[model samples]
Target: MGDFKVLRLVTQGELSWEVETRYQQCYQLTRKTCKKIKDRVTVFQAPGGFLFDIFEIAEVKHWPDTDVSEFTSITEYVDKTLSGYFFDQELKSALKEKADFFTFGVDVFDVNNDKCFSHVELVATYDTKLGKVSCWTGKSYPTEDQKRDFINCPSLETHCQRLNGIRVLVLGCHDLNMFSPRSRASIAPGTSKEIVINQMQKLCDQFKPQVVLQHPHATDSANIWNAGWAGVRKFLPEVKTYSSAIHYFNTFGGEPRQPLTTVLNRTATRDVQNIVFTCFEDGGIDLV
Candidate 1:
């Protein structure tokens, strides 16, 4: 178990009904490829963090079609999505069978449609030593209710204690969008580099992570790419960073507009050897 290595899977592109099958195929292919290279994998684990999982459930419920002007009828979307039509039973079973740890992202909005808070949740981790799954939910941005719940939540307290030696942080594509000047407009207005830096500072202060993973899909220019890295380093100085260039494969005509290899290699200096780059073809850079 100690010999396991970390395998980070960075997915690109938006979710759609047309490419849903292909997306699942790609995920399975990636998992199989990783397994062939090395088994006994654990995702986010030290030395080797490769594990197999199935399905990503992202759904929004009770969202107003137009401006509702009230925060009423808000429901747990995950439960509804899981129970609704088109939900993949096989995939859900596979996830339950394969996933030992689960990470969730939460965004809270007010009646005015403004994002009041955003947080990441780590929950229900498997303990190989204990030979059972331990239940927990660790939240990054805790609300007053969450804080009250945490006080009475033994599992959450245990999870926090278990994270003492862990020092890795994972960022989603939306998180990476903050670094791209062109893409920043696609996100919330007034979202600037400073806002992103402040968020990173909050996370850094809470986690004190030694390694940061940045997963962005498409970067049009070298300047944009470097700016993304600079944004991360500015908040978390001297931290080792790992990023995936998965967008190269998703480009129109399945061809990159620019030579991704050239860009990655040029940026990979000895001084920044820790800032490793990877792609879908290569699976990922081995952390071990």
Candidate 2:
């Protein structure tokens, strides 16, 4: 019922898989990008400008990895390795420091069994009105995923929250097609009548979220993720769907990589909802 703008920072660079890199990503986002975030907010000040609703970072942007998991799940990785700073308390403080809204994802690992770990991408969203951090893990891993270790959470669970009087539905990477039969292919092989939950349609029909977001850390071509969005429209036709993602510096096609803002509809350039997709080179991943 409310109209809002989202400012997405799409960073382009060679990302590090070392677990410690996530902290640096956090610093770049919170400190270096602080001024741009604030100035961009003022430029989009309500009344005359698009009242920016969310400041989005590419999926796993502040986290280590390039659509790959170098570490294990929330508990195994963050609990033992990073310790006190793992929750990334700084990211939370940025909700109050940088902008009224901010979000980003981290790559984590999960035990597929006892042997190797499956990749689990985690996304965290913070809103001024909400006043707390909300985290959600990717619910699906497509059969097309080249990675051998993938855990498709078959529970039909997804993240749906209310921010600034607007209901927001968040999707991480392949969760864009969580209910697709193919998405469940490798996971639930011999199923009873193929348990299809129609999770998205159900959410749209029941919860009626106004906005849906897709956060992907893509190292592949734009066509790769665009194909997902093409499939995503059917399930989320009733609301506005935005994919805030990251790509390698040399990523192909023309998918906004330079720092610029665009309207949600992609028809015009606003200012803040006006998405500004910025990039950071190898070690200079910081926005500043």
Candidate 3:
């Protein structure tokens, strides 16, 4: 696990769907910490400090164990504890160039040999485009709703509405129905059930998400995908869908001039459907 290395500092903030403020902060932090992986280990200030899960970007291991003991403070963990022990030989210059744009709010971290490497950068000074400092570590961020995982369409819609302002975006993986590389070899009722449950749980836990909108067909049940009407009968049997809280809409077959509409607006405006919830080939959308 200690062998886990920083791949490269990915510079494409727009591609990562990060907010401009957070994006720029990540860029600055990367610049300050851009040392040849073999030269020195870098650390920075984690705004909320190490308590948040975002501190694991360093790819250290047994991270949860460290939370209880060691370090004078979260800042000390990065600047002193981990940084002090990190040998210059551990880093390789070739890999630093591969780092990508990341943020501290989403709390990106990785485990490596009882140590967790967190890419954190908190800004004490505020600049218009550079909000309260951030990071560029690569990790899954929350949806517009600030939710790591989602259970039903209502939750998905709720997330979308919250992202109306700013770069917050709502995206889905369409076309591919319930297929993950992790579950490729088997086919069973238990397998399908487990797959949905595991995916739902992990997404929520790691991402700490609100809505995880998935196609109804992705589930073991066949009746759920009838235009997303099923709405988590099995995945969330206890939850109730409040009519006032949910919005249902379709994203297909609109005028060429004005297509992709949601149920939020009655009129067919061009911007109304700009952000449609989906279930397609890729699902990497965010506010930026």
Which candidate's TM-score is highest? 2
Q: Residues 1-288, candidate 1: write the lDDT tens digits.
A: 132224433333322222234334434533333343333333322110112112221122121111111111121332233234222454344333443332222122232323322112322243433333343232222223433211111121222222224454544333443444444444454533344434555655676655444333344334445655665565555455344333333344454455654544432232222112233333323211
Task: lDDT for model 2, please.
Answer: 0.43
What is candidate 3's lDDT per residue for 1-288, written digit by digit as tens?
Answer: 121111212111122223333333433333334442233211111111111223333422221122212211333344332223321222222223323211122223333415533332211111112222221111111122322221112122122211112211122222112223223233355642344435544433444422222211012112223222232333333222211101122223332222212222221112211122221112232221
Best by lDDT: 2
Candidate 3 or 1, higher TM-score? 1
Better of 2 and 3 by TM-score: 2
**lDDT score, candidate 1:** 0.34
Per-model root-mean-square deviation over C-alphas: 11.2, 9.3, 17.7
- In candidate 1, where is summed lDDT lowest over 10 consecutive residues? 63-72
Residue-by-residue lDDT tens digits, candidate 2, 1-288: 224655555445444443455455544544455556643331111110000011112222121122323222332343333334533555445545646555556555432323444444555554533444444334344435434444333333446766566766666656655534344354454442133334445656677765666666653345444444554455555566354444334335565443322213331123234323233433345442
